[model samples]
Target: ALYYDNGTFFTKDLPKFQPYEQQANFEYEERFKRTEGKAPSGSARKCHFCLHRLNAGMLPACVTTCPCGAMYFGDKNNPKGLAMQLLAFNRGIRLKVSQGTEPRVYYLTSEVGTADNLKACLACHGA
Candidate 1:
């Protein structure tokens, strides 16, 4: 199951393009940022969006914990070419494409008007 999968909360560098203003809430946190100790504090991963954020060539915590191998992450650019392939596979269906904050994490299928999948993922991830 997908966890911490919110388009807004769990991805790396959001695209910085026009009409896609980044929401303040989706801003990344630093690894060393102080948390307020709330059950759902937003500061835990602020570092995820820092200018220095980059793929370490390993899975993130949730990805590593996934038993079903449903999640995949990699460069949309470069020799990886995985993202290009995915886009080709889903040419017509819509994703969360307008967030201006282009999240590197993408959901493979369409969840166009349904919050169920997104909610389920968040609950699974404890977000």
Candidate 2:
């Protein structure tokens, strides 16, 4: 489930969309060892929520580097956490709810006017 949500499957051959050379750089090697260890080619790769930083009592880079202060990360089970408070206050919604994936990420959206407006937006986005 975690892989499906945030993983990227890399191939030796270039991909069709936004193709780029899959070369071994310093960061690539470091991240590979840090996350998916000893995986074969074409395996899924994803950051494991920066486990090294978490173990060192630091927040993930995404949450720390968010310039707008829109991202929050913490224990979801903690009632006093800012993430939970924002979720409750904004009535956050998870994507693909019918799929039963139970995604860990939550999104907050602003009012898009009437139901007709929402339908139009979804239709345009092919949601």
Q: Residue by residue across 25-109, what tens digits does model 1's lDDT show? A: 3233423322223213342343352243334345555555665454554566754476567565653334567867555656676
- lDDT values, one for every candidate: 0.45, 0.58
Give TM-scores for every candidate, taking all chains together and pairing residue i with residue i.
0.39, 0.52
Query: How many Å off is the CA of 106 in candidate 1?
Result: 2.0
Give the Cα error of residue 90 in candidate 1, in Å: 2.7
- Enumerate clash totals for all models, in the order shown: 7, 0
Q: Name the regions of candidate 2 deviating beyond 4 angstroms.
A: 1-43, 111-127
Model 1 residue runs over 4 Å out of place are 1-56, 91-99, 110-127
Query: What are the candidates' C-alpha RMSDs?
Result: 14.0, 8.8
Q: What are the per-residue Cα lDDT tens digits for candidate 2 across 16-108?
A: 423222333233325332132234223555556767778779998887875545568978889898878867777578888889977888876
Model 1 clash pairs?
Answer: 15-102, 20-100, 28-46, 29-46, 29-47, 30-46, 30-47
User: CA lDDT of 127 in candidate 2?
Assistant: 73
